[model samples]
Target: MYMNTLRKRSFQIYADHIRPYKGRVFLSWIFLLFAQIIGLVPPLLYKRFVNILSSGTSMDTDISMLVRIILLVVVVYIVMNICYRIAEYVVVHYVARIMADLNQTCFAYLHRHSHQFFSNNFAGALVKKVNRFVNSFRVLFDSFYWDLHGVVVRIIVATCVLAFLNIWLGVILFVWSILFIFVAFLFIKKKLVWDVQKADQDSVVTGVLADTIANETNVKFFVGSSREYARFETETRTQQYLQERSWMVNYWLNVAQGVLLLLVEFCMMYYAVQLWRQGLLTIGDFVLIQSYMFAIIAHVWDVSHIMRRLYEGFADAEEMAEIFETPHEIVDVKRATTLVVPRGEIVFDDVSFQYHATRTIIEQFNLTILPGQRVALVGHSGAGKSTIVKLLLRSHDVTAGKLMIDNQKISHVTLESLWQHVSYVPQDPILFHRTLMENIRYGKPDATDEEVMEAARLAHAHEFIESFPEKYDTYVGERGVKLSGGERQRVAIARAILKNSPILILDEATSSLDSESERLIQDALQNLMKKKTVIVVAHRLSTVMSMDRILVIEEGKIVEDGSHKQLLRKKNGFYKKLWNIQAGTFIM
Candidate 1:
């Protein structure tokens, strides 16, 4: 079953990338075949020269005749060289182009995948898989172009020549070739599996490193250097052990191949001399066979090497195939259409969701935010607040209900079009390693300089931006690490402001900011949210007190929903109690 799947995937990969260059590839192989045949003429010419030299009569060989033969040989050699070079170039170019297309397709598919796919995968591991897969195309091309096709043609031609001269030597070399191939394949099969295991272990190590760096603040605050290092070392050691084992096996395999080659060489020469002495072959024929035998043997060994390399490529390709072929759990409906400009009415009807096998995050919940209304969600961690945002963004589909935007079912519209009308400000904003202007412009790539500055001003970020020596061009560093929390939040707000969508989602966007920064950002948020459907996930009750309505969520259920004053009047309600606690109006 595994082998069948590998074959199918390999074919799919080839078809996806190689099919476009079929004519070029076919012509290349045809020229390569002709070049291989022309290459055989050199050994034949050398054999004739050897015969003439041994005769000692030298016909006083005509200088012109010798020069002509030498020139002819040189011309054939050059043609062979040029043709093969062209073939190699064509193969490599096609391989590179195909790998690029495959990688792009994989990325596009991943972009459409539901949040669960990303949450369940290690980001670094997936990145490594893509890198390895693209690299494998080069290996695949190298192996097939030079080793598989070229070597096989040369070997076949050489064997046929030897067989016509003497069948005994032909039989011997054929048997040796079969044995050599079998032994090489055995070693390669084992090493390929080992290499894949090593790659997986390496991916785990990389994932750990990514996590450690991403969580550097937590690690440093807890002084967890030793712990993190130990974990990293464990994965590293496993990867090293697997790689070493594979290398050791490959080394011994090459040793065996070398030994077999030496034995074959010795036998071929010995038999060639015997045939010559028996008058079954001329000295020139013997020399020709000997020379061709050496070339053929080298070609055979190279074929074995190429096969081993191919196995490694296949392993990497298979790993990448998983990611490229992964199902997108959230996808547009059949015949999906682009959404018209949104009017900002959002609705969740009887929505249910489960994050894991045993955990249900939301169950049969119904909610609505009318056009131009502002709603705040108050909940503890894992109370389905963020899940609502994810559902709205179509990052994940609802398990058993409907989500709509402006009276249109979200699933019926293309995801790109859906997001065009919605802009989200996440709690932890992600900034690329680029200038501040580039990061802000990411929201609306075509925004003019004046428009960018205007948006920055509205978000209260223009002042600090101007304070920097580079101003808008200042590099934010990795993940905006060079910037303060408030600065990053303002950048995030500026991005949202630039987007200026009909629906706004502030997912604890102000959580990392100081009180003063939050106050300033809050004013910007109000302006941005004007006439838009707004949903705010708030941890601090004070931030959402004046919201048009607040929904208190607990254990995946909406336990209370009302205005602040109305909720405060109900002593038994969760929101009223929470408000009283935060207000410090109740006895501890």
Candidate 2:
């Protein structure tokens, strides 16, 4: 069943990937046919020259005729060569462009996929697949254009010419040609499939090596280098074994082909001698018969190799097509409405969600925040606080009920517009490998330097930022590894401050910071939250103690909601218990 699916998918890829270039492909075929015709003319014209030379005519009498025929052949050869070069150039250029376009389209689709897709596949495998798709076109053309059209067509044309020269020799050579094809196919077909399987196995091994190296830091930290090396060696040995087997099969098949060709050559030579002894055949006729016979036989041999290559091309194409044909699981609604910027009123009416069926996170919860209000969510780990933030951001839609912003259903709004008014700062902030100023500017691309500095000041990041050797020009290493944890957090706050969105979400934003840094960030947060609707997912109990309201979530449900003082007054409440634990007054 898997093999059948792969075969069908291979053909589908050819249809979809190649259909757009049909015009160029057709022109290439036409030029190839013209070149083949011209090539065959040389052999036929040579036979005529041999016949004329054997007539024992005086050279001076036939000089003009010979010269005219030679001149005609020369002219035809020159024209065919020029056309062939032009056609070959165009075909290769078209194929290159098509491969580039195909790679881009595949990558674009990949970019829009949800995070889940990436998590399940190896990064190296994905990269290698795209690279293989790009390289396969050249191989396909080399095996397809020359072998199929050039060699196969030449064989057919030569066969007809041979038959016309002498019926008996033609019949014998034709029988030999058929037998050779059958013999080659018997050995080559199975090996072609084996070769293709070997190639795929090689790609898988390469992908595994890449995936392991990419996460080498984790492996080394865990002291698993020896184990990883052993695993890799095992995979490599398996791939090498398959490759060696494929090579042996192909080598033996070629040997069979060579042996058959030698036998056919000997038999043809015997026929040529027999015909020469008979009165019915002339020297020129024997020459013509032998020339056409060998030409046909050579082309038949070339085509046998091509037939095997066709199978190999199909197999490689199957791997690439599988990736391309995967349907994107998420798609935007047709003509979805854009979410208009509101006064930051948000509502969650009986919302529920689950990343998977067995582990429900948010469940049957209802909440509302009036415009310009600051609301803080406090909870223990696995209390669905982060899930609530994700739902609001529409990273994953709710499984039940409705989420709304200013009474506008979030599902109706376009994802682009919905995110326009939202600004988020995560616990582990991500920073690009760029200068500090450029990184901050990414939050608001059109902001002036002064505007950026103002935002930095607001987030309490500007003082240290300007104190650096390069000031705002300082580079942040990959993932901001060059910056301290507190500094990176501040940088993230500054980015969100620059966005100046009416809606802001802080997801454990101060979890990694020292007490002083957290206090400073809280002060900056106080400033940023003014005149905005703020949803703070707080792990620190002290962070939410001064909020307008607090919601304590547990087991995917909001079990407590009120001002901080009110929740503290309820001694048995979830919020009270959490506060007691954080304050070291209770242990659970």
Best candidate (score: TM-score) = 1
* lDDT against the true structure, each candidate: 0.83, 0.80
**lDDT score for residue 79 of model 2:** 84
Which residue pairs does candidate 2 place in steric collision?
none
Tens-digit per-residue lDDT, 384-476, candidate 1 = 899888888988777889988877888899988998888899988879999999989989999998889999999999999999999999999
Best by lDDT: 1
- Candidate 1 lDDT: 0.83
The CA lDDT at 226 in model 1 is 94
Kindly report which residue stretches of model 2 are placed more than 4 angstroms away from their true locations once superposed: 1-14, 17-21, 61-73, 167-207, 279-309, 429-495, 512-520, 542-546, 576-588
Off by over 4 Å in 1: 62-64, 89-93, 584-588
lDDT (Cα, 0-100) at 39 in candidate 2: 76
lDDT of 1 at 274: 88
